[model samples]
Target: MYRLLIADDEQLEREAIKFIIEESFPGSFTICEAANGLEVVEIALAFKPDLLFLDIKMPGINGLQAAAQINRVLPECRIIIVTAFHYFNYAKEALSLGVVDYITKPAPPEAVVETVKRLIVELESASFKERLAAEREQQLQQITGYFEDDLLVLIAYGEIEAKEIEDYFAILNLQAQTFFAAVATILYPNTPGASILEIEKRVLNKNVVGWVKEYMQKVGRQAYIRSIGAEVFILLLAEENLDEYQARLTGMRLFTELKEALWKEQQIALNIGIGGLCNETGQIGQAFSQAKYALRYEAAPDSIISYGDIERDQQQVFYPYHREKRLYQSILQGDIHASQQLLEDLLTWLREHTSCLEAFQQKVYVGAPRQLTLQIIDCAGSKQMVGPAVDAFAAQNPNIKIDYIIGTSPELPSKIKAQQMAGNVETNVVLTGYDAMGSGLVQQIWERIMPEQKKSFPNLEDNYLPAAKAAFDLFDGYGIVFAWCPGGPMFTYNPDRVKNVPRTTDELLAWCKANPGKFMYPRP
Candidate 1:
């Protein structure tokens, strides 16, 4: 709803304009009135109305002056001048003062209604654009967050090149030139009766990574974290490189706070290892190694081990945690090339570090299903009708997952045909209208539900209404009428305005001709 202010010294003029608007466009506006020029400016500023009607010849500092002041403060407020005279100078001044239009005194109700209607349309259009822009910005932010996570994973995995880091930084719009790396290892307690898997599930299955991210943000640190199985790698970005002492102090403070919080609140224990400062993007891999090296030391669970304090001579055993996570992420994102390259890297590592039989066994299980998504293309606004049926189907067939893509009746068939032509049939099922079903039948896009399949639903025909049965018959065995309703042409008319209800198209046309500007109908 929009706010509207009508300012005039003549109370009747204000009332006339208010009545005209209320009768024509009820519930569209919240209205206010002003008796004089001072009241007009004061109420306009305080109310912050969207549209204002100001009388030109008002007592003390006329309408033009009030409009000028209001425009300075509320530039978006549309001003309409209400004047008794149609003098050229008055219009010229009103236009110069940014008045949208002028209403001559004793204006027709139709003219007043039309002006408000046009302004409302303009306001709605502007509001829609604002909402669209906000949604776009929100989507951009979400995409940026995904890119940040991918970059952090790459840094920790030691697979990203210097050029790739630069490109990521540019995409993320990051100002940080240096960063610190830390590795946090979740250490499950050795329970007497509980199994290792039980303990791990209780601790690791909790959103520990999410907690750490939220905690880091609360502590005012710009950090990115990625969980790789039992360990989480943290990248704390900085605008400049920190000295050895500063890095140690900062790391100890953050790690100690995190360690205490997790143990005290959730009974989760963390053994953290802090790496030395990284001066450039290329040094992130080395820093990751340092953090891992520091993590291997047999330190107290609460105590954070810094690489600067650890001995450099000892070599830490290589782990494929990062590489495995990178490969998993690549596969999930459908980056086939990256997945193949990472698979090769893992195979090479296995060749050097393990036996041939072990490598062969691992390779054999590479394509095992971890997660799968089933996509369904559906007509818009049909979710409420189809959602419960889909839910029931999913409940009975628990293994089948479903996702929906909403489209128009015409658009759904085009999208499915396009996907089929591209040799990537993403749409597993289509929930659409009869028009699209008929179109799909013509396009040979639908297959008949065979007689063998009908055996499973022996009572399906008995349950269907006659309308649905008729629709099914029209499909010629290519489709089934999942839902149906019986409805015909309908009309609604005001009894006072429309004395004789038209029963046919010819009668309706005759009535429209007899009483001009008295007919209304919705577009198909």
Candidate 2:
């Protein structure tokens, strides 16, 4: 229902307008009246009307002044000018202030009713957007809470921005946990106007994230997710062997639902990889290797594959490591016939299984033209040729559907560099391909599976110390920078705002700027 306020210096005019409004738009609106600007302000505050019937001249403050003042307080209120003068200037000013209509005093009942009816449509739109904003804000807050909880896994890149992250963390104190780390790459193809933040916001709406959380909670799993890049993410969570498969499958279903609900016309496909399970919580570094190593298979015959899913039985003498030299020599030696033959064989292998970085590189160097092939030549000229070599690596991971080799990588704006990510939610992550299985980070991460503990908290400082350390390593402690992770919402640390922790420099500055006098001791 629409609420209206009539403010006129003359009591009779106010009464007249009110009666006309009630009669014309009967049961459609609630009416409130005021005699002056000050009274208008008071009534606007108290009554929260959706529209205002304002007289041009009034006692204490003229109609124009009152409308301007009230506009600041009640920006949503639609103004309909009721004045004695039908002067062009009055009409122009009404138009400028965005008044619904400038009707002369003693307006015909029909004119007044028509003006008000128009105002209602606009008021209704504004009201809808306002509700959407409120709901988005509340859901964001809940997402923050989910991430900060110790048992949940989390991954973020740029979507939320930094200040809100600090605010979120201040509200949700980070609870340390021992978990596995994995990344899910969400790919958006030729989506011109679509953005990671929009995707993140849409996912955070009613069903998507909530359903995933509920699914994990019900089955006793833990993970957190943030839209990290244009379409990528690095997720950290705790998982057990049996449950990991279930979690991955369930998350894939949620992803499908999210795309259908939030994405219109855009095709949302995900390449998810699972890092080897870390046996000890202190060895999350190993998971990073597993996660990164899992990235190797962009060329897999199938879309979703895991590090543990492929067979490594073929090669002797570590084909990914040692055979890399032979592969490079095979290409650089400029043996076109040999290179072409090797390439054909490699393509055949790719046709059979998903691509993993090491073997993929070896296959490519022996001569293949997947996008990364060019970067391999560039990196070879300057620096290290050992690990998978490329610039803007995602550019090489082609989405077969588009026939373009571009992976989502997040680039945060200057304004939001400091804010941290949603730190601790139980995120659902799936990675495919890379599998060297490196340092302690990845080792301990996927080793343990988290139990259902949304309502339960664990006390394991020693084990969690490393997982937290690994999370920061992946994305400065804010979260992993996966494509599709929203860019703006980074976390910032403020003693006063214990909820959020800033992840980058700009986010910290923005927070300080927003909070006038708050001092961050570390910065000073």
lDDT of each: 0.74, 0.48
What are the per-model numbers of colliding residue pairs? 0, 114
**Number of clashes in model 2?**
114
lDDT of 1 by residue, 331-445 (tens): 7557999999989988988777664556555766776555556787777357888888888987876667888777667456656665543334678877766667866775666
TM-score of each: 0.38, 0.25
Error of 2 at 34 (Å): 41
Off by over 4 Å in 1: 1-126, 189-191, 196-206, 315-524
- Over the stretch 1-524, how does candidate 2's per-residue lDDT look in tens digits? 78888988877577667766776777988888898878987888889888888877667877777777776777666777886543332433344353555776555567787888766665557475576457446655654554453222221222232244444445555333334455555453445786556655455433334544554565555555434433233333443343545644544454344435334533334455555544444334345345545655545522544455555552111122212334554675578887777676656655655545567677658765443222111101223332242334434555321111212111111101112223322312212111111211222222222222213334422334554434425432212212232244334455675556656666655554455335322210
Instruction: Give RMSD to native, each candidate.
Output: 17.5, 25.1
Worst 10 residues of 1 by lDDT: 84-93
